[model samples]
Target: MDQFILTFLKNASEKNFQQLTGRFLPHYFTLISKVGGMISPETLTSIQKALQEGRLADIVSKIQEVITAAENAVLEVAVIGESGTGKSSFINALRGLSHTAEEAADVGVVETTMHKTPYQHPKYPKVTFWDLPGTGTPNFLPDTYLDKVGFEYYDFFIIISSSRFTLNDARLAQKIKDSGKKFYFVRTKVDSDLYNEEKTKPTTFKEDRVLQQIRDYCLANLSDIGVSEPRIFLISNFDLDRFDFPKLEETLLKEVPCHKRHMFALLLPNISDASIEIKRSFLQEKIWLEALRSAALAFIPCMTFLMGFDLPQQEQCLKGYRSYFGLDDKSIEEIAEKLDTPVQDIKGHLKCLDFWSLVKDDSIVAKSINCVEAFCAVNGGPSSSVVQGFKAYILRSKFLNVVADDAKHLLREIETVNIA
Candidate 1:
C-alpha cells in the first residue's frame, strides 16, 4: 500500500493530486451511501444527525472536513537545555536551518534566558521549537522554569545536555515526569567528541560502536538518576545525522499522541529519506485544505494572487517543497559555514527549471533569506554579481526547480498509501 501511494505521488502533477484529495471525500460518501443501509445503526444515527444539523455535504465536502480537522490538529513542543549546550543550534538543525546568519543568537554558557524563543516551522507553523533556558542552576527550580516557559503549551519537553547528566538535568527531568509531561534526554556535542576521538585514535574502535557506548553510558546514568526506562538520544548539533536524530524522531512519534505526531515529524531536520517521508506525509495530510482552496482558486475567474507580507505566498508553498526535498536554505547555509564557503557559493547551483517559472524574482529578503545570504557572503561566495542582459527562453517556469519534483513525488506517495 505504501509503495502504491509513493508511486502515485511520483506520477501525479501537483494540480491533479490536490483535485484528487477534494474528490476523495465525495467519492467516499458515495460508496458509503451505496451501502448506507449496511452501516451499523449507530453510524446511521450519526449520518441522520449530520443531515438534520445541516452539516452533511456532498462526499467532497465531507472529505474536506476530515482533512481540515487533521490539518488543524497540530502539536506544540518545547526544547529546553543549558546554555552552551547548543540549544539554539540544535533548534536550527531540527528546523532544517538555512543560513548561519539567519540562525538565532546563541546565549552564553551561564546567562539566564528570561524569555521563551520560538522558532516556528516555516511550512508547518503549528509545530514550533521553543528554546527554554536551562534550569540547571544552583538556585533554579525545574517547576519554576516550566512555569516561566508556559509548560502547558508544549506537548512534550526535550532536555538537552552537552556533557554528563548533571543534578539540574535530573531535577528538570523529574519535574517534567511529575508534571505528567513526556521528556527526552538529548546529549549534544557528539560531533566534537567524534572529532576529538578521531584525532586521538585515527583508526580505533568502530564509530558506530563508540556512539552506542556513549548512548549506553548516558542511558545508564539517567537510569541511576531514577529516570527509569530513560531514553537517551545522542546528537551532534553540528552533524544532525551523525548521532541519534532519527532515533529521537521515531521515539517521539511513538510517544506523542497520534493526532499531533505528524506535525512534530514535519518540524524535524530533513536529514534522510525517512525524514523526508515523514515531512511529506504530514504536509500531505495538513495541506489538504489549502490544496483544495488552491484548486478552487485555480478555477476562479480572476487572477487571485496568493500574497503574504512575511513570506510571499508563492514562497510559502516553496517552503513546504524545500522541507520535503531537503532543500531548506538554512541547511545550505550551515553547510557553507562548515566548509568556510560563502553562502552564495553554496547557492550558486540554485537555478530555475527549464520551463517552470513560479518565482518572478529571486531576491531573498525575509529573515530566513537574509540570514542565509549573510552566512554565505561571510564564508566564501562572490562578493557581487554583474548585470547580465542575456535571458534564457523557457516554455513554462516553475516556482520550485527539480526540488519541487521530489516533494511532489513524496506527496503522491502519501496519497497512495493505505493508512486504513
Candidate 2:
C-alpha cells in the first residue's frame, strides 16, 4: 500500500496527494482490499457506512454549483446622462456591437430613451447595461432620478457628457456616492474633438496637449459642480482603442469586486493588444480550477470510462475559452468582416485543434487518450486511481495552454490585419 501510494504521489503532486489523502484514500483502500479479497468484517461495515453516506458526489456537485454561479454572475451598469450625450452609442460600444446592430441600444442624435432600457452585452449576457432616460428634463428631476430609475438595481453608474460634466451629473454622482454606489464620468465623442482640432489647427495642435486640455476642462467643471476628486474618462464610441478607454477599463476592473472584475475584463472588446492580454490572463487563472473540476468529474462512476478521463469537460472548457477570446466561427467571421480579410486567412493562424471539431468528435477524445496513455507508458503508467486523477489534471492543463496559445495567435492575426 505504501509503495502504491508512493508511486501515485510520484505522478501526482503534493497538492493532489493531500486532497486524496484527506477525502478519498480510505474508500480507495477499502476498494482495493475488497478487490484483493482481504477485507475484514469490521472494515466491511465501515465501507458500508461510507457507501451509505455518499457525500463525495454531493460535495463535488456543490462545488460545481458555486463555480457556475460565479461564472454566470450578473453585473448591472447604469449609463446615465442628459439628452444627446451619446449614452446609447457608448453602451453599444461597450457591448462590442455597432450602433446599427440589432442588439444595440437605440443610437439617435436626439434623446431616444424614455425609460430605463436594459441592453444585455452581446458576448456576456449576464452583464446588462441600462440606458437610463435623459436627466434634467421636466419629468426626470436630478434629486429624484435615482428613485425613478431604480438606482438600487445598478452595480455602478456611468455619467456621460459630450462636453463638460453638468450640475445634474454632479448631483447624480453625489447621490450615487451617498447610496454607496460607484460612478464614473465619461466625456464622449472624443474622436470628433481630436479630428476637428487636427483639421483646424494643423501644425499648431499637439494631440497630447489637446487631450490634456479636454481632461482638465472636464475635471474643473466637475469639481466646480461639487464632485470632489472627479475622475473623468474621455472616450469615443467609434474608437475604443484611443483616448482614455483602456484606462477606464483598467480603473473599472480595479474598482469592481474580485468576482465581477473578470466579467468586465472578459467582456471588453478585443480592440487593443493590452485588452487581449488581459483577457488571456483572466482565462489562464481559471485553468487550474477547471482542471480540478475535470479531475473530480473523472472520479464519478459513469465518467470514469470516458476516454481521456473527462475529455468532454475539457473540450467544453476549451470551447468556452475560444468563445471568450472571440475565436468561434461566428466571432471569427465577424472579425474577418471587420478586417476585410477572408475567414480562412484568420483560421490559418490558429495553433491548436479546431475547437468545434474537438467538441463534436468523440474520436478526438479517444485519440487524445491514446496519446496520453502512450506518453504515460513511456514515463511509467500512473500506479493508482488517484494518480490517474492527477494525470487528467495535467492533461487538462496542457490542453488549456494550447487553447490559450491559439487565442493569442488569433489576436495577433487580427491585430496584423487591422494594421494592414
Tens-place lDDT per residue, model 1, 312-353, is 444556655565465567555655555566877545555422
User: In angstroms, how far off is 69's CA in candidate 2?
Assistant: 4.0
Q: Whole-model lDDT, candidate 2?
A: 0.68
| Residue 197 displacement (Å), model 2 | 0.9
TM-score leader: 2
| Candidate 1: regions farther than 4 A off | 1-62, 107-115, 122-125, 201-203, 284-420
Name the lDDT value of residue 256 in candidate 2.
75
Q: Give per-residue CA lDDT, model 2, range 378-399, as digits (tens).
A: 4464434434454454454455
Q: How accurate locally, in lDDT, is each candidate?
A: 0.54, 0.68
True lDDT of residue 96, candidate 1: 62
Q: TM per model?
A: 0.59, 0.75
